[model samples]
Target chain A: MTSRVIFPHKVLPYLLLVPQIAITLVFFYWPASQALRQSTLREDPFGLVTTFVGLGNFRQVLSDPDYIGSVQTTIIFSAATALIPMAIALVLAVMADKVIKGRGFYRTLMIWPYAVAPAIAGMLWLFLFNPTIGTFAYMLRRAGYDWDPLLNGNQAMLMIIMAAAWKQISYNFLFFVAGLQAIPKSLLEAAAVDGAREVKRFWTIVFPLLAPTSFFLLVVNTVYAFFDTFGIIHAVTSGGPGKATETLVYKVYNDGFVNLMLGSSAAQSVILMGIVIALTAIQFRYVERKVHYA
Target chain B: MPERTEAGTTSRSRRSPWVSHAVLIAGILIVVFPIYYTFVASTLSLQQILRPPLQLLPGSHFLDNYYEALFGGLGRVGGINVWTLLLNTSIVALSVAVGKIVISILSAYAIVFFRFPFRMTFFWVIFITLMLPVEVRILPTYKVMVDLGLIDTYTGLTLPLMASATATLLFRQFFMTIPGELLEAARVDGAGPWRFFFDFVLPLSKTNIAALFVILFIYGWTQYLWPLLVTNSNDMNTIIIALRKMISYADADTQWHLVMVTTIFAILPPVAVVVLMQRWFVKGLVETEK
Candidate 1:
């Protein structure tokens, strides 16, 4: 925000800006613009024809049962991925926050999963739950419960959800730990002196103080579930058994890359982009509310 | 709030510590389980994996599986060895990181320090790109890559992914914190923008550069859909895509041992970066989010 003393140079700044702008235009903007155009135009799979369809593509996508189902899948998937990770991370963070012993070691052991790619997370779980080869799946069968992610939609959804949530726990945990540390120790001590129990102190004081962090993680985890978990669905279930795990992002990939339905896919992309923009707006709005809370 | 001190040395005081430890230990186990499974599975033979309830502990096949994984034991994916896959991945990851840092730094410098027309416009342009990830624009971006004749090449793999709004914003924020007196001093010495940037600004940016490198490297290394779409040849395939191909386990005769070995290989570099540079990785992540 500071307007610092400027070193006088007209050409140099433009020169500095060129590479990033050029790359952005060529890669991000041009393609984004092309998606906007393509969304309004239907194209055959052969790559030879085009027809301007306007809202027809959007209409088709909105009315399609598959698209409707995918929207539902996305909501469920996003909520579980967001809530489960945040809940686990909050508990772990609270527990870890209690003691100083082995804190660094526990953090080191916990946070490395943030480095695992989404697809790799899917693969890791895929092997663990493989009907015959997977250790956990084998155990499930041994307990007299039928377990086949490959065949069952609920099981497949659960598999991808677990993988996605597992990968995200580290991220949320790190943030929650940071948030927990940011809380003033004096406040907790004051609460204790007032005869407030640990549970009472956490629920009344700590949890309220962590609202901003909780809300931030909620948006981030939701956005992640929407855009980033495509790899999980793509690898684990490929939206399979019966389109059980096909999130909106996965549907976008499948429509364009797999099925070659250009118009529909482009339309879906526009809708997704709009959703993200709205989510960003909501984040900013809630962040403003948190300023008052703090 | 995780603990409370009782004045009378009550019964609840001593028992609370154990509860916290128990919960923390249980969390650590669940977090470490999958990676541990991968390591243990890699140490076992194929027969062990085929049967249900594989050994929980490491088996006796470590060298055999890792040797196979590293030395082309898996089937020919685009006719490339697993070693080549590792090499390609490293190249893509490093190039994307370095490329992003360089361009983003330059752009951030321009936008932050110099007053220029359309500066705010350019900043907003970059900001909007954050909302449009590769997932949404895959079709058109793939077409552009095809048109540019970059498919399956290193340029194709890293270049498109290098245009980063986050890195630029990070640099811009960091540069703002540098005192304006430095710029005044440099200007009074008759140093030009280019000279001052190289001698003054970049030196201050070293830690940021390193931090961004760790974050971006992991990002590029773990990319699934983009690299999967662009790099059609196995010779050009990164470890992630190669691993995915290896484990279409339902249809193919997946060598579970070798697959596990490759999983470790795929995970090692980025995880190494995170663990080794834990301080900077955390700092960089928290800063970027802000």
Candidate 2:
């Protein structure tokens, strides 16, 4: 009787995963296959005409200047967005971990930006940086600096980066703070007893113990930078100031939806998917091994 | 643990609390100033908003801007009222939240309790989808929506998102941590699986469920790309999409005041959700990570 009961409990986990499995197959695998198929065909506004072009779309995208620019922009955007937020969040998390009072208030306010929709975040930034009416623009003009993100490529990229990082800092902070808290309090005390200063204690005790949390945040933050900021770019810049803000996914949205070049867009999507998958696999295999999961 | 230090030594060893407070205050301001600026900007008129020196105080145009953006004025492109858009967004978000939670619970139970074939294979496949970004499969998913006649409808907007792999994975992991003796005791008491799930399992799983609810609600509410593609008409547009339309129009005409107002309106719902759900939200992340 005990064995029979134990067997069902053991097997139950697998059975419960069925709907997720089915949904993944239908919505994920089926669509992925369809995207792959559509990328090979010649698609017009009216309909798609299927023909196996044997990497023609891929070749066209790889050689195209616009595609190349998008790839470059995406690399820069992802790197900056990921690195900046991680740095800021790490510092904030450490500070928050040290403080005792008003922790909840600080956390609540810090995560407020994350609550705003990305499109809304873009719109708010758009208003704040408006050339004529924007408060930031007014401050810049008063300080003898020309502030026009909409007109300058570099300014536009910087604004987008700032917005993305601001939105993400709270999320990363939450994870980091939690990770910091989970580190046994005794470790820090032990370090302090050994004549370690604050900075030395953090470097020797806290940082080493927080490796797993850091790794998880790194993966999550990278994925977010690569895939989630399309809406932000769409609202704020729309790949504007001469397409300077056109990251890979933003370009995919343009080619696929706005321009109705479905095949080429699908091709771009496939390439992006491949890159993300490869990066993720490499991250898990190489970086995760370094994570000290206590 | 170290020996207890004298009070003087312990107090002297710490940095000045005032300095830490100052740093914290500065960080908090940087995090919160945008929201403050947004609210202030929404209150100002277009001309004042555009003036060389930007207005810092709350302006007289707050009601005017709100009225215009919500009801159409100053050459605003008119469509559904703000109330209607909020209602639509709420309906879609609420339904998606409920559907996702229910499905996640059941699916999690099945996986946690039953003997099933190809279980690990199934789990791996589901895990892989968590890595697949929505942009990759959107084209075909959009086609599926059109094929099933779900476009321009609430059912269409919320259904595809309902069966969330993230929620399932989360719940399954949480369920696995529950004590096995509870299930055995329930079985001995002659409770069926359904009774066991409802009576015993669910009560203990409230924290996880609450966390999942907060996360899913935010995800559903903030969904923009899919809703934009499927719902073409203004009547069907959720707040996020509606806000996008407002910004696009403002971008074309350079109507700063109206844009600010619409942006404020767009942010209110998600902000409300976050404030209400913050506790669960953090708890969920901590649970999942652990």
Please give, for residues A1-294, the per-residue lDDT of candidate 2 as tens digits: 123343345545655565666666777788888888878877545774556786888888999999999888888988898888888888888877666677788888888877777777776666677776666877887889988987999889988888888888888888888888777766777767678888888888889887777777777777878888878898889998898999988888888878878779889889988977876786667444744454
Off by over 4 Å in 1: A44-49, A284-294, B1-15, B76-79
lDDT of 2 at B211: 83
What fraction of the reference interface contacts is present in each model, in order? 0.72, 0.58
Q: On a 0 to 100 scale, what is the lDDT of residue B187 in model 2?
A: 81
For model 1, residues B1-290, the per-residue Cα lDDT tens digits are: 34433432242244467888899999999888998898899899988888868788899998888877777646735456778888999999999999999999999999988988898999998878788899889899999999999998999999888889889988998999989989899889988888889999999998888889999999999898889889887788889888877776445476777878888888888899899999888877765663
Mark the regions of model 2 whose C-alpha exceeds 4 Å error after superposition.
A1-22, A43-49, A279-292, B1-13, B61-77, B251-255
Top-scoring candidate (lDDT): 1
Candidate 2, residues B1-290, lDDT tens digits: the string is 13323542353237865666667688888777787887888898777766646555787888888988777743443546777777888888888888889877887677667666676676677667765667876778888878889899988888777776677777877778777888788888888787888897899888888887777777778887878878987888887887777767664466777667766777777777787888888888666752
Residue A224 alpha-carbon offset, candidate 1, angstroms? 0.8
Each candidate's lDDT (Cα)?
A: 0.86, 0.77
